[model samples]
Target: MDNLGMVFGLTGAAIAALFAGIGSAVGVGIAGQAAAGATSEKPDLFGKVLVLQLLPGTQGIYGLLIAFITLSRIGIMGGQAPTTVQGLLYLAACLPMGFVGLGSGIHQGKASVAAINLVSKKEDQFGKAMIFPAMVETYAILALLISILSIFGIK
Candidate 1:
């Protein structure tokens, strides 16, 4: 009970890394499958498929960034340990990145998969096809900004 604050902070950091990482892994896997399928039929689209597959990978980076920030702030990486309230605050801060990363990552992967299919079918539509997956990244970016701001804003 007494260690609740630190526990919360630690858990938040863990979630930032774990959930986001899982999301990226799943997303990449999904995109990779589509990419492979597309490439098998149209080998020339390898570059396009690769780009689409990597779009979801950004969420993992965002999650990792949030995790690093949380850990650093919580004094796990260094510095003084936060109080119970501060720890809980860290947890709250991490939530945006964790949840958003997970959702956006998976959705982006789906978007990428569709994009890959489009590219496979119409090589000239690559520009428009890339936009769909890129749009999904907007939410992940917003979440990342919120988490970073929250972490730094916390005293």
Candidate 2:
């Protein structure tokens, strides 16, 4: 690929990573606020709320991992650049994590908040409450897998 193609590929990957980070930030922020509110009322639920808050962070880690892998494939990590179409494709593979992770994280946060409320009131059903939002995280994992496979498969 040409220099411009590599640039575009890198840009896409950076943007994807940024979006994923932002998604995680937003998701964690929302969940944290709600969790704090809940904790104030029920100090005993701190551990559960903390777990829920952390769940959203997984997407950001996935994005960062994909970006690093993509960069590695292009030799970007070692201060070199992609010089082939396949290398460009590897960089482009970083896009899915951002799009999927962003929305999924937010939705997951909302669900988790609802779940937290349910669990807080009915301690016996904590598992049931946690499951709904955790399930939403499955999409983020799928996106990460696709991005990783695409980057590796391309080159």
Candidate 3:
């Protein structure tokens, strides 16, 4: 039973890292394709496109933070195993960041692709174009805040 609690805690941590990494990979890959295509034609837009491509990557970092916090809280990093209920709470705590990061990262990637195309076509519209993807980042940030708060709130 005690071992099972640790298992649940570890599982939550792994899920946080795994799902978030997948999301970031998908998002970065999608955005990178668009960035490459845009930069090929308008090499001067490299900096702007590169930034857009990197936007989705932040979700992965957020996920990693959640995982680290979960591990520390659960004693996985070097402490006593959590009780079953505590372990379950930790698992629940990781859910928001993992799920939201996945969704937001992919959506942000799509937004970045659109922004990249817009900037490629209208260089002067770069500021406005950046707004779309930047907007997507707000959701990821929100999820991160919620996940962090949840983890911290768990005694």
Candidate 4:
């Protein structure tokens, strides 16, 4: 029972890393399929498509960062363990990043697929195409910011 707080904190860290990683994997897989098809037709577009395919991956990194921070904060990485209330607070703080990363990564992937198609058809529009998927990244960034702020704010 004394270690319950540590368990909760660890769960929070796992949730942050796991959900975001799953989202990124799915997003990258979807975008990779589209990118492969596009590049098959025009190898020169590889660079452009690759960039779009990787855009959704940022959320996973953000999630990982949150997890690391949470772990460190709670002393899982090496310090005093948190109380149950503090552990719960950490869990709550991680939620935004987990949920938002999941949704945004998937949507961003779809957006990247569309952008890939657009670029495949009109190579000159690469700049404009990049914007579509990049827009989805905003929510993930916002969630990351909130998670970071919340975690650090927790005493």
Candidate 5:
């Protein structure tokens, strides 16, 4: 019973990292496929496509940051353990990042694919091509901000 809070906190941390990591993996994989196809014909475009493929990976890093913060906050890494209520709050805080990361990562990957196609057709359009996928990244950044703020705000 006493450890319930720890369980919840750990679960929250896991959710934050796991879901976002899954999202990044899928997103990166999707983009990688597109990149491969695009570069197959014009190997010179490899550098450009590689950048796009890596963009979706930011969400996973954000998730990892949140999880690390959560763990430290809940005393999993050090101090006193959180109360159940605090643990629940931590779980709530992590939700935004988990859900948003998953959604944005996938969508960003799709967007990246489109951008890759655009770049493949028009190499000079690479800057504009980057914008489409970068826009999708905005949501992930917002979620990361909210999760970090929420976690820090929890007493």
Candidate 6:
């Protein structure tokens, strides 16, 4: 039973990692395309587009954090097995951050693409354009918070 708990915890963490990585990959890829298009039209906008391209990276970071928390809760942090129930709780803890980060990241990419278009026309609008994607990042933050709280609640 104890080993089973750890297994569930590790599996959930792995799933979170997978989803988050995929989300970041897709989001960044989309952003990269937008950046390329913008840069091709106006080479001077390269710097602006680069920042947008990097924005999606936060999703990966959040996923990593959730994975770490889950592992820690499973006692992988201390090189021992956690209590059975704790491990099960740890698995549950990882879900919100994983899904929310995944969904938000993909949505952010759309905003990034729009921002790139805005940048193409008015360089000064780059900052304003970023607001859209930045707002989307709030969802990731909420998810991260929930994961952290859930891990703590597991005792």
Q: Stretches of candidate 6 above 4 Å error?
A: none
lDDT of 5: 0.91
What is the TM-score of each predicted model, taking all chains together?
A: 0.96, 0.90, 0.95, 0.98, 0.98, 0.93
How accurate locally, in lDDT, is each candidate? 0.89, 0.79, 0.86, 0.91, 0.91, 0.83
Q: Residue-wise lDDT of candidate 5 within 1-155, one digit each (tens)?
A: 99777778888899999888888889999999999999999999999999999999988998899899999978889656988998898899998999899889888998999999999999999999999999999999999999999998987
C-alpha displacement of 82 in model 6, angstroms?
A: 2.5
Clashes of 6: 0
Model 3 over residues 1-155: C-alpha lDDT tens digits? 65777788888888778888788899999999999999899899899999889989998998999899888877778666888987888788788788888898899889999989898888989889888988988888887898788878877
Better of 2 and 5 by TM-score: 5
Worst 10 residues of 6 by lDDT: 78-87
lDDT of 6 at 26: 84
lDDT, residue 6, model 1: 76
Report the lDDT tens digits of candidate 1 across residue range 1-155: 76677788889988888778888888999999999999899888898899999999998998998998888767778655788998889999999888988998899899999999889989999999999999988998999999899989988
Per-residue accuracy of model 6 over 1-155 as CA lDDT, tens digit each: 54987888897788678787778888989999999988888898999899998888798898998888677667577545766676677777888878887898898888888888888888988889888888989988888898888877765
Residue-level lDDT for 22 in candidate 6 = 79
RMSD of 5: 0.7
